[model samples]
Target: MRPLVLLDVDGVLNPIGRRPPGYRRYRCVVEGVTYVVSLDPRHGRRLLGLAEATGAELVWATTWEEHANDWIAPRIGLPSLPVVAVNADTLPVSGHGEMFKTPAVAAYAGLRPFVWFDDQVWAEDEEYLRVHQGVGDFLLVHVDPAHGLTSDHLGMAKEWLTLTGFSQGS
Candidate 1:
């Protein structure tokens, strides 16, 4: 079984900042609010290349949810991808201080190995995975919100894919 690649939008693809060099600004309306997100044009190609190299399924794990396919995907040249449904009643709800997406991502991953790319992932989330999900089968990559996903991060994902034995096609 191919490992799942869970992708977050806010910090993973669309970085948070005053628009760094090479990043383009895009306005998207979600829930009646207009949000301006910074997206690096290269990210799409890199992510797609990663998927091709690892033969992993790229799944959306962002708050944008289905809107990711509608808005962000085309902007970055990605085809439609499976989205992990996250709701208020889900295990990752607020007030727990744990990342609202941690449990949801884990649950979505099920027994399949997964690699989660998010900006908000912290040590506590890692601890939760260590205790509840064990270690080797999963990877939680915490991206810097200011820098977004860099070449180093992609390198890490590729390395994880290789280390986890997910690398087969490329």
Candidate 2:
């Protein structure tokens, strides 16, 4: 089975603050909420390349939910991808300091190895995935809200994908 690359939009593809030069900006309204986002088109190509090299599937794990396909993907030159159902704006309600989406993400991943990219992922979230029963290998990439996803983050995911025995299969 192919591993999964879980993508977060707000802080991964779209920066929460100042972005690298030449990023395309968009004013999006989802469910009556306005969001102004900045995205580098190059990120789409890079993410696609990483998926191809690792025989992984790119899945959305953002709170943008289904709107990622409509508002986020095309802005960054990516196609619509499967989304992990996550509750938005929710704090760590489990009391273990884990993000609210942890349980849902773990369920979606099941036995598949996954690389998660998000600004919010913390050590606690990693531990939650690590200790999840019947869970597969996972890499939590903490993206900077200020800088967004970088080559360094992608490199880490690439390395971990190899370590997880990823095969570039047709």
Candidate 3:
């Protein structure tokens, strides 16, 4: 497998901040709901670099879904990427600890090694991935919604991918 880098748009890319330094704000209207987003263009380059260094394919895993491809990708200078089929508006799972999107993420990843960047990852989500029988080496990079993605998060992913032997799929 080529491995995967899963990107989340809302909290991971668009921080909780209304407007932050070094980030450009954009207005995106999808189906009549206008959303304002703060994005740093450098993040695109950094994410692409990570994927290249590790021989991974970047995929979107966000509630924004396909809209991410239209609005978020171009702003960050990233090409269109595959999106995990998960709905953020989906109701919570009966399991208290598991995230609603966890099952879809698991299904999409299958046996591939995946690095997921999201602000909502909890211990239970990590455990869910870890205990799965067929999942490959995975890294859950917890991005703070307030600050968005940082170089430190990318470093953690690189280190994990390298240590796990998933780097370059070698």
Q: Quick one: best TM-score, which candidate?
A: 3
Over 1-170, each residue of candidate 3 has an lDDT whose tens digit, in order, gives 77899998878899996656799999999989999999999989999999989898999998888999999999998999998888857644648587788878888899998889999999999888888677777888889899899999999988888788888854
Would you list the rank order by TM-score, best first? 3, 2, 1
lDDT of 2: 0.87
The collision pairs in model 3 are: none
lDDT of 2 by residue, 51-162 (tens): 9988999999988899999998887778999989898465335678898888889989998989999999999998988887988988999999888899999999998898
Task: Name the lDDT of candidate 1.
Answer: 0.82
TM-scores for all candidates: the values are: 0.90, 0.93, 0.93
What lDDT score belongs to each candidate, Candidate 1 first? 0.82, 0.87, 0.87
Q: Candidate 1 lDDT, tens digit per residue, 1-170?
A: 68888899987898787677888999989889998988887788999999998888999998888999988998888999999886546544534456777777767887777788999988887776666653347888999988888899888988888886877763
Model 3 has an lDDT value of 0.87
Model 2: how far residue 9 lies from native, Å: 1.0
Q: Per-residue lDDT for 34 in model 2? A: 90
What's model 3's lDDT at 32? 98
Query: Candidate 3 — worst ten consecutive residues by lDDT sum?
Result: 87-96
